[model samples]
Target: MSPVDSNALNELYKAHLAEQQRRTEHALQRGGFDALLIASGIEKFAFLDDRPYVFQPNPHFKLWVPLIRHPDSWLVIRPGHKPRLVYVQPEDYWHVPPEAPSGFWVDHFELIVVRKPEEALPYLQVPGTLAIVGEADAALGDIVPNNPPEVLNPLHYARAAKTGYELLRLREASALGATAHLASQRAFGEGRSESAIHNAYLDACGFAERDLPYGNIVALNEHAAVLHYQYQDQQAPAQSLSLLVDAGAHSCGYASDITRTTGNGDASFQALIDAMEAAQLRLVDRVRAGVDYRDIHLASHRETAGVLRQLGIVKMDEEAMLAQGVTSTFLPHGIGHLLGLQVHDIGGFMAGEDGGTIAKPDGHPYLRLTRVLQPGMVVTIEPGLYFIPMLLDKLRATPAAANVDWALVKHLSAFGGVRIEDDVACRETGAPENLTRDAFAALI
Candidate 1:
């Protein structure tokens, strides 16, 4: 692994600060606020216990400083002067408290340490003029006011187009994830249990489960039919047929959501995987500036129908299958979603910085991202097909039942599903860059 370029990171933060300040100033003008007061957020206890769950700092606070080392900190940003940071260093015996943060980024902020949350309140002037931008901090609630959507929408919208710095981290995160995916694929091909394959992924990525952006989905055979499959069987099935691994890795608070499917002993299943991969690549090529994402999503449904018809899995014409919703039973969910700091990052449907949102099409309600393609935006293109019993059963009762080849369905159902996903970044020109594929190539 190569070292992170600290100067580049500093430059990224500088660009991010400029963008944020622009959004904040616009929002403040629109919402009648003087300054923005942001809390890094505090830890929450797990159910019925004092133990804290994994802590995630507020995206607003982390935006300015990737303060992965500190929690319960606060940030105050105004039009002028250096940004102020209220660093927290707890004096506790049970666990090791964070040391005062020291990094290339530290010099950018005016830092102050407080043992408790209340001690930091005295630093703010005219708190009533400030609009809160993070987790609810009751200590400052009496003074600071809640941030209305007018103030938040623009900031959320600004994140959709990442800085050059964020793009670098995202590429690194995708590379890390692809490394783990290769290990998991090998483990699956070797007949290892789902639990073991998942462990191999973690070992390859060098991170704990809590550190993951989202829970890893390691599904084998029929288990792949479950969209959010969670359980990891302790023992491998006697007949290992298919593997569907949806996992990712985090790099400096950025994430890469990638999925890959592999098959065993069945040429037809391999063909299906190839078809999906080809279809996904074609769709990814369309992810450039000025393209409407919903149109791409609809295009995916059309291609899926074509693939199913080409394979004799569905008998109806492509238009008929799409019109009757027959295509959804086999390949449901959106073609892809925005990928960045969060797995399903925010601002996917927002129409503008003032906070207008667009609704998903009636037939395709599961789509997470509806924004048009733009330069610097990153997204995932995941297209899948499954032989799920429940969906198949429903299809069997519908008018579209005649479209499906029940015999072929029965024959291939045991092999589970096929999904091919890749993370791509929309460019200022030409086709989007496939970050996941580029990462996988590095392994060779």
Candidate 2:
């Protein structure tokens, strides 16, 4: 569990509706689209649907987004063209909650619905030319990007920069995640197991009055040595174990990314943690705007190398350590990704703007953010070090390991892993300020 604020969800849709109106107007101003068909964000498929796991009772009952521009408030293309809104069913009035603002639509546009979502296309004022307000199906021919496409993805170019209201919701969500992490920290001990720690997260999320975004990673002992290790991955030896939690809490749609590691109170483990924390700081510093993301990733890699070499894990040569592929054994996943409406936010690369890349190559393929950072953008800066036997086996099979002193790597292998992740916001002065509370970092 990351974090959540029930109050945010109550009024979130109204703000989204307002943004939808702005997007519709902007899309119409761009060209010759007669009408834009809108769809509810809720759907049958399990994950994408915003509804809770238990709410799958009715397939069509999913009313995620308010479909019509407005029932009475419809838009007509110069009084002759047809209006917008293609929906799942064409009958009952949408039950607008009392909190929702009224009158966002003009009566000119027709508010029509249909049993089959695809059937509404034929009714479009200009069937072949309408820009979709939501994700379109692939069966609709060249009208879409490539081949046949049916449903249109209502594109919102404006949502990339978060509004003040959105930031508040996001911060509320992050706090909940912090709460979960603290509770998880308590659940991990020698006799306790990974499942126990994972359950602790769910309990904490419940206590904080929020929902869990995804399952938690409660790796204990040697199991914790492997990054991303959950119950399905592996488990601890019941003793001499540490824990790593890669979990977040989502409120409405905003998410807070955070990771915490456990130590078995061993002296060597503390030294490994010392190195990992220092490397994490170096990586966290890279969250500033205008900094090349690739540079940040590499700087983190090099920083890890500095600490590792002093601990005698590898030779001091940064390039040589990289060439040996020893670093990949510990940290396989990317440091972080954009956080917002989705667990992995979009606008990675905009349509018309040139999104340049500075972070590239060797073990960084999953680097989600490729462009320079910008103010108002939220990102997680998570850096970790883990040890997995399979990865160690692979490194041993390679010739590069000849240069790697395995005895040194082996010494720290049993120490489990250390990861420290924090949510940050890019400032106007090209620096990232921590969105998490000061006390949280103080514990580190």
Candidate 3:
């Protein structure tokens, strides 16, 4: 990434850091509490709003966590004349300075540091329902009603609720992810291996001025069904086949996840994929506040399965098909998760004061949602259909598999999977807007 890419984020982070203070002060007044505490790490909290504040051997350690005791803190600027910041120093970096640009938390907030904070910080000695955040869990202490949720842990809670500035940054990031995907998709059609396409994604990140987030999954045909399969140096097919690539980029400290599936295949397989894309369109265009996300997920699966069964891939009862948990034979993971500071970010599962909920499916132990949808939450609804041996075995062993069309399954077995994911902003008034879908389509 160029210096310009790094500088823009630095400016964005400063503005966000200022907002953290405003939110903290509001929390203190309303909760009748003393302030908040945050525990950070060098490798754990790797967020860069615009640029790195302190360059570390490990690049992901930079972050700004807030300590707020009340909800109103987000709206008020502390009653005290100025805000306070406890700047901890890693034992090794105790002598070096903050390592960030000038004027970072120097005037408005007090900066203090402690070594081995969990074992030695004087503030943790403060006796109140301390609402700890970030790495503050057991180190700062636990939360209790008598002690109360004074300190919010996982600072990601507030992060899940994007700021106007953050939304703008995310928009740009989404666009970049689309651009990268398209480049890699083109490489796929040209007979590039899955690894070749994967490299294209990294190159896109560099050119787009972003640090490549996580390694991407570029699966073609049977390889796509492996889900999360990383094809680092494998050969790619040259024939009409299905290509499933799940990739994204980390820009301005937020993550953008967008998946696209293209095919050089028979009419039947292509039609099946068209059905998957249609399901994505149906859900992406209507996700707003009050949406029971489970309904959306269920609908996507139901629709995908309906298409497969209609296409003669499955010879089972419609209701029983989904009930048997057969979708795993195709799409193995949750549609998607909350995307932000940490990729999966945080929140969306807990019952927040905001009353939003994203439910987790009992059958799919990994399904992360656990509450009803609410405004201010951003999530991905990536639904997929694949044909994997392990999952197929599990499903076929069940009584519900009796009617599945074995012949059709054989045909789709080589087709792999179809996944379409887009980042969506949940809103109060209308449908949630898709941030990555159009970009993905443009590439195809």
Candidate 4:
């Protein structure tokens, strides 16, 4: 069972509401609005007469209420006042009407249920005075005026720093996801096919495909070299060399992303995996409040180069290899990214609390995070080393090619790659807490 206490869920809910109110009030003042209306969003439909896609409550709306139902529910917020929920309960046999949630958060909001979403407009502030968020099409026509980026950007920026409640959900997510990783890892060792391993992971976590934070990446052997290896080959190789599983789980509305690599009795390949894991941990230790995330990413490259030298994969010193961009050939991706409601959470590159953005450094377009580390922020520290044939072929044609041992690369490439990812939480002091580590420890 998850370590998250049931009573704590209520406490988390209360804390979440406080944060939402704080963000909403600040946004309202900055955007020059007397009130804010956040919609739960409407269901989307596919081509022609296709059944509507499963409803995903607007992140903004879910931040305020746990209700995930469709039918265009809404939230009304004003400074120093109790918020209101314009609940929608459709009266139809085609689908079951959503019952009002009964929880610690429900009492905080003055609930008003209506048969149609438009009926709740009378309970809101004047159209022009209220700023609307969520689905633009779900708006009650002129009953609620829309607030553009100017109003939304502030809230988006504030979400980067999580509250105590959000952290708890994140911890639960990490702990749960670690269990799934353990199951998948064992399946690989048992010579299970990639598809079978993927199924084992989901079954262990009790989550459906759509319920996942993102699609699972279950790759075996050479297939691991593909950055976003999407295929889950039905057949397992006669001799399994390695396995890479990048998967995650959700708790409440938060997410935990984790990746692990395992070897199949290949001494050299196992050594590389151990080296990558150790280097990843050392990099994770660098996560602390006030540290620049980009610096951590660069540090990872330098460290990865050192590992390559130790394994005789790179001919030059770590510094020389980094300077020659040889490290990029092995570890091509950004060290990691922010983790939260969205897997690649928003505001990663936001310039400030209100708006603007910071561009990724040149030649590092895949880097997803750019902000300086701060307390209450959670991010993934994933460092990878791969012997990709395409990248290796390109490097083979370059002058820096001499820095690599082609024979070793050819032998190691068959084992694919190694990636060690952990969700880390920044602290006001000391080393950033390793959620993945704690999650795994909890299992024992």
For each candidate, the alpha-carbon lDDT, in order, equals: 0.86, 0.57, 0.62, 0.86
Quote the positional error of residue 231 for candidate 4 in Å: 2.3
Task: Give per-residue lDDT, candidate 4, residue 403.
Answer: 73
What value of lDDT does candidate 2 attain over all alpha carbons?
0.57
TM-score of 1: 0.96
Which ranges in model 4 have alpha carbons more than 4 Å from their true place? 1-8, 69-71, 91-100, 118-120, 124-128, 143-147
Please count the clashing residue pairs in each candidate, in the order shown. Answer: 0, 34, 32, 0
Model 2, span 1-444: residue lDDT tens? 233354554455446445445555455545445454333323333577745432111101112232212221111222234334443343446633223222323232355545543554465345445543333432232333221122112232344446555666577667778887888888775355566666677788763323455556666656666666647333435464566787888654466778877676777777887777777766776787777566777776777667667776655487777766567776777777666665566654433222223445566777776556777677778877766788878977876666566875666566566888877777778557676644265435
Using TM-score as the measure, which candidate wins? 1
RMSD of each: 1.7, 7.3, 7.4, 2.1
Residue lDDT tens for model 4, 7-117: 787777787788888888888888888888888888889889769877787787877776655558888888878888888887889878887567656787888888987
Ranking by TM-score: 1, 4, 3, 2
Candidate 3 lDDT score relative to the true structure: 0.62
Evaluated against the true structure, the overall lDDT of model 1 is: 0.86
Pairs of colliding residues, candidate 4 = none
Kindly give the stretch of ten consecutive residues in candidate 4 with the minimal lDDT sum. 139-148
Q: Write down the lDDT that model 4 would get.
A: 0.86
RMSD after Cα superposition, model 3: 7.4
